[model samples]
Target chain A: MTKAVSSQPKTKRGIERRAKILAAAEQVIGEKGFAAASIADITRAADTASGTFYIYFSGKDVLFRELVEDMGRATRSQAAERIATAANRLEAERAGLEAYLIVVRDRPMQYRIVEEARFVDPDAYRTYYSEFGKAYADQLQQAAERGEISAGDAEVRAWALMGIAKTLGERFVLWEEGEVDIERVVAEAHQFICNGLAP
Target chain B: MTKAVSSQPKTKRGIERRAKILAAAEQVIGEKGFAAASIADITRAADTASGTFYIYFSGKDVLFRELVEDMGRATRSQAAERIATAANRLEAERAGLEAYLIVVRDRPMQYRIVEEARFVDPDAYRTYYSEFGKAYADQLQQAAERGEISAGDAEVRAWALMGIAKTLGERFVLWEEGEVDIERVVAEAHQFICNGLAP
Candidate 1:
């Protein structure tokens, strides 16, 4: 994958234009998929000249990586804010799951784009999840140490929790045509997470 | 998606040939992905003439769907057999998860092909998971009635458990370079499933 050389915008106009192209790319690629979507299509969606795309991204691949990276940043920051206000690790999990579902519901395209990254740009896909997994494992480890939760394999628990959130977000939020009952879904799942199936 | 109308082969030899082609397609498509794996490549891998492929499958798409469908059948049968031996839902969950991980380890290609179905054939992907999720929810409901497991919302808990198995299989079995410690991973995750993170 060719890395984009132009990292920063020199002026306000340049910054806005770059952001415009990235946003357009996300929509175009997310809908049409990475293979079918063309740079021309993205430029058309952005209402910008085809040449202007090069001014920001070297090519479509760079813009895709950036989009995936941007989603990671956006979700992590959002979850971090919600989690920080929680009383403990279990509460943090609830807050984080709710925040994640909201993000998926609001920006369904971003979720599609990230999933498409698995096939379009394998490295970016791996990096995105690996980084998230690392941070999640760290938090779980700390919680276990503090006796906030039952101790087990932090890495396994982290991945398991991530899996639950991801699958639920896909099945309930993204795929559902009608408005999903996010509150009810979260509350039920939270119960399971707090206390397992043992009667 | 154009559905293939070809019926089963009449002769014993013809049946074996068709089976060989499907096996080859699994390996070829699983390794090279759907877009990159051509019909010719699959035929070559099967050691059959390219024309023989058409005799069995209308095209690559039909063959791909068949492969995915075959995997679902294989997994469900295997899990059902193992789960039957379990005493209750918790034991069933342990057996089911263990069975799933073993399948991933033994037939990693089938796992990859199923995931690739999301992009290659979206409907098949949805049907695969939807059917699994519905059955899982039913099982959970029954278990709750029998006092096998404490269930709050069967659908929510079913999806959560599925998610845990899916992600763990991906990270620990499919992606691991070294031998995966299946016993240890299952034991740790099972503990979490039986008793949640509550202190």
Candidate 2:
């Protein structure tokens, strides 16, 4: 029997190069708005051939949208798993915010892309955000059903909570580049929403 | 000798033309994404000559930024006037939300411009949103100081409240086509935020 040679490279180095291209594209899109970034600039930054980029992404918009969807899904997945194990409402709420913060802080480029997607493509925004939002809303509904929280329309309150948490994350926690303790910020926000400012 | 005709007509008309151009620009940019919009489109929509647009704006970017600023200022003015006249914490919250809804409903063009600005220009976004945000924050702060609400951080709570109100306005109340009772939406939002789910 004759041995057959495979055309594809099986080396780990090829995979690393593809990741490098995505990372470079993320950075370029972050610095200059995504609409302004060109493939040539991305390829140059990635230190790869123009042909190599096509191996990873069909185009910039595809890459941008995928980066956004991945980050949002990853954040939600981590939250869902943790929330599933939480003992109470407070713990679940805390876990949810913390999960959001982790994704946003770790992958800020992804957050920016998701935020930008709101204006760029409303359908993508609805699909990406609404799915994650519905999951969180389901959690909140469960808490209300269990009588752990005040009873009213859970969906509206869930939407309101999501809005509040997202605004705070964008403002004080995720966007801050200075030396600041994130733990305290998250704690304050979680408490304020879960229990509120009332005594 | 004939009295020298004042050069002021040119300047006065220029200001009017600039305002007209900006008003038209907001609609065009909002309906068509900024990247897709052109000078010809804006000028034609505004009913002003193409040359008149150049006299006021260097390009679409200049016109868009100014439109955003003007919208921000108008929204803030409504907020400021409401806060200045409010009787109490709950009433102030109501007034503030009403102000936001009225501005958003009356000037859908401005709302679109603000939405676009959030995606494209961070500086303009901050300049526009934070100002209105702070105005709302100040109302909450005063309410807390007067013992109308809890003594927790008013600024943080205010932002949270604003986030909810704005989200509801954007996602449900304002964007939805057809007969949207702005008054009812504002009332429900105010009740939810100020009184919580406790009935």
Highest TM-score scorer: 1
Residues A1-199, model 1: lDDT tens digits: 5646656788999999889998898899888888899999999999999999888878788888898998888788889999999999999999999988888887888998888887788889988988889899999999999999989999899889989998999889988877798898899999999899998
DockQ of each: 0.87, 0.33
How accurately is candidate 1 docked according to DockQ? Answer: 0.87
Measured against the true structure, the TM-scores of the candidates, in listed sequence, are 0.97, 0.84
Clashing pairs in 2: none
Which 10-residue window of candidate 2 chain B scores lowest in summed lDDT? B1-10
Docking quality class, candidate 2: acceptable
Estimate the Cα RMSD of every predicted model relative to the unseen true structure.
Answer: 1.5, 6.5
Clashes of 1: 0
Compare the candidates by lDDT and give the number of the best one.
1
How would you encode candidate 2's per-residue C-alpha lDDT over B1-199 as one tens digit per residue? 4432212125776777767777788888888878888999999999988887766666677667777888768877887798788777777777877887778878877777777787666689877767766776776677678787666666567667767866666655555656767676665555566555432
What would the TM-score be for candidate 2 when compared with the true structure?
0.84
